[model samples]
Target: MTTIRTVTGHDSAGASTIISHGPLPGCEEFIHSPGFSAALVWRTPPQARIVDHPGDPAQAESVIPAPGGSSALLVTFPPDDLAGGADFDPLAAAEELCQRLPGLGERFEAEAPGFHRTDTIDYGVVLDGEITLELDDGRTSMLRQGDIVVQMGTRHAWRNRGNTPARLLFVLIGAQRPPRGD
Candidate 1:
């Protein structure tokens, strides 16, 4: 028979040391810009939904109740709500934001602008500047402001290819697995 030992930190580390934590708190980031802002919230439990947009550089958002888990919402502040502390929308409110400027894709860098492929499904809406898109399937498209592109499970990237620094209110929705304990 083989013998093994299981060590317990509470008894060994003494009173001053905190052995292990039961659970940890999740984190998120809020992006604020001159004309737009975004809030990102994560869940402690596993992810459940995947608004698949493969190869597209943009992310997605949702409010479905996660089974046996919780989710965070990242909202963008609206223009009118500025003084009164603008209201935020995960994406529903972010849809028509870039109606005035031209668009290319999700990410449009000033230097060396081209395709930056991704692993999951993605969605993009152009807010400003012109965009140039090239896909893995040799399909290409251009988006002006106020256009929405849904890319599900394919390789893709974006290029501003313009003189200005364009902004696309991005939302990334990914695959959500069940919690480890679940």
Candidate 2:
């Protein structure tokens, strides 16, 4: 599916104007993980300043926003059964994920698969279809279209157990993890 992203910014005259309108740059379906797609929509570094031409922040190096930063992403997941088929290539898939997602991709646990954690608070909204949110304790929450989830720097993973694909939008804000008590 083509995701048309429209960006707004202030013109030289200080009037709000549409900066760009089209499919997100670099957004593509994963060849190794057929049916899966992810797009980095936007990003803002710490203490972001408003500029007349901000350009496209989606091309930034890291997907994991730094402290006080934020990022927006759109992800589509195919059914669980669709992954790791006979033609599936794990190494290629991992390489592609790391290259596309940058820091965020490295956070995924190899031992536990989808399980991962980050120092950021995320607000996720189910855009279409159904999915299951699994936490570290193995507890899961079934979510459907329009459902929302506030993830607080927790270890979690998303599972699409349904027959169809599921789409989700997430906004993540960088956060500081408090010092652990000994």
Candidate 3:
């Protein structure tokens, strides 16, 4: 479980206040298999904007917000040895996620050629254990504790080659692509 401390400012006094501080009510847990589990920490609305007064700024949902919104999530991937024979369905999972999160289905690939791409910039940090980021071009990068990765809308996948669960924190921000001709 992860704890999130949210701070806000008061409109009248302009003083910082700890609005809510604690673990999330519950995480959107996705059980890819018996051992692999992923959780969505929190999500913001498409039109989210900071306000002067304290109020609800982040709408609760486990999906990509509009093209300018963002979301944060925590994922724990089981070791490849354990997950090797696990029954996993990436397409089904992606379909379910797209149904819950608008615009996500468009980026999902049932047969993504071992990689999936989304039109969003992502910031991923290794929180515990280790994992590998594999690209469609056959290149891979190992990420360990405290390491960070900035993924720009590219085809990729996260793989846990180690013998332990790999935990990661990822923040995805929606972005716009330049016009086709530009």
Candidate 4:
């Protein structure tokens, strides 16, 4: 699936213009994980300043934005059964994930499959198919197309139980983790 992203900016004459209009450079379909794909749409550093031409901020070294920063991501999840098939090579899959997702790939727990936590507040919207949000304690919430979720900084996993693929858009805002007692 191709996701075209259009970026607007000011021209040399200080007039608004279309800076870019094409698929994101960071978009990729996971070869190891069949039916899975992701696109890093855009990113902004802390206290991002507006510029006539901000250039392409879609390429990222890490999915976790710096404090006061933000990132927009589009992800498609395959059915749970498609994961770790008989021909699935764990090492290859890990390498592919690391290469495609960078810092976000390393966040998944090795001991617990699909479970990971980040120091950010994520606003997620289900774009297609259905999905289930599984929390640390086995709690689950079903989400369908048009559904939205405000995910705090909590350990969670996404599960696609249905046969069809699930697509979601997430906007993550970097935040500082509070003290344990707080």
Q: Against the true structure, what is every candidate's RMSD? A: 18.6, 1.3, 3.5, 1.2
Give lDDT for model 3.
0.68
How close to the true structure is residue 65 of candidate 1, measured as C-alpha lDDT?
22
Q: Clashes per prediction?
A: 19, 0, 0, 0
lDDT of 2 by residue, 22-141 (tens): 988656888888888888999999998888777888768899999899999999999999977998877788888888899988888888878899999999999999999999779999
User: 1-182, model 1: which lDDT tens digit per residue?
Assistant: 11122212333334333333332211112232233333223332344443222122123233222233333322222232241235544342223222211121233332432344332344567766656666766677877677877765345655445555344434344444444596
Error of 2 at 109 (Å): 0.7
- Provide the global lDDT of candidate 4 against the true structure: 0.88
Instruction: Superpose all Cα atoms of candidate 2 onto the true structure and report the RMSD in Å to 1 decimal.
Output: 1.3
Candidate 1 vs candidate 2: the TM-score winner is: 2
Candidate 2: where is the Cα deviation over 4 Å? none
TM-scores of the models, in the given order? Answer: 0.35, 0.96, 0.73, 0.95
Lowest lDDT sum, 10 consecutive residues, model 4, at 22-31
Q: How high is the CA lDDT of each candidate model?
A: 0.38, 0.90, 0.68, 0.88
Alpha carbon lDDT at 135, candidate 1: 79
lDDT of 4 by residue, 1-182 (tens): 77889898998999999988987765576888888888788889999888988767655789789879998989999999987689988778878877887778898887888888889999999999999999978999999999999988889999999999999999999999999999
**CA deviation > 4 Å runs, candidate 3:** 2-12, 25-29, 42-48, 52-62, 84-106, 179-182
* Candidate 3 lDDT by residue in tens digits, 1-182: 55564655564587666665665532444444445554456666668766565444334443564578887766677786776355667666566555544444456555652267776889999989999999876789999999999998888877888988888888888888676697
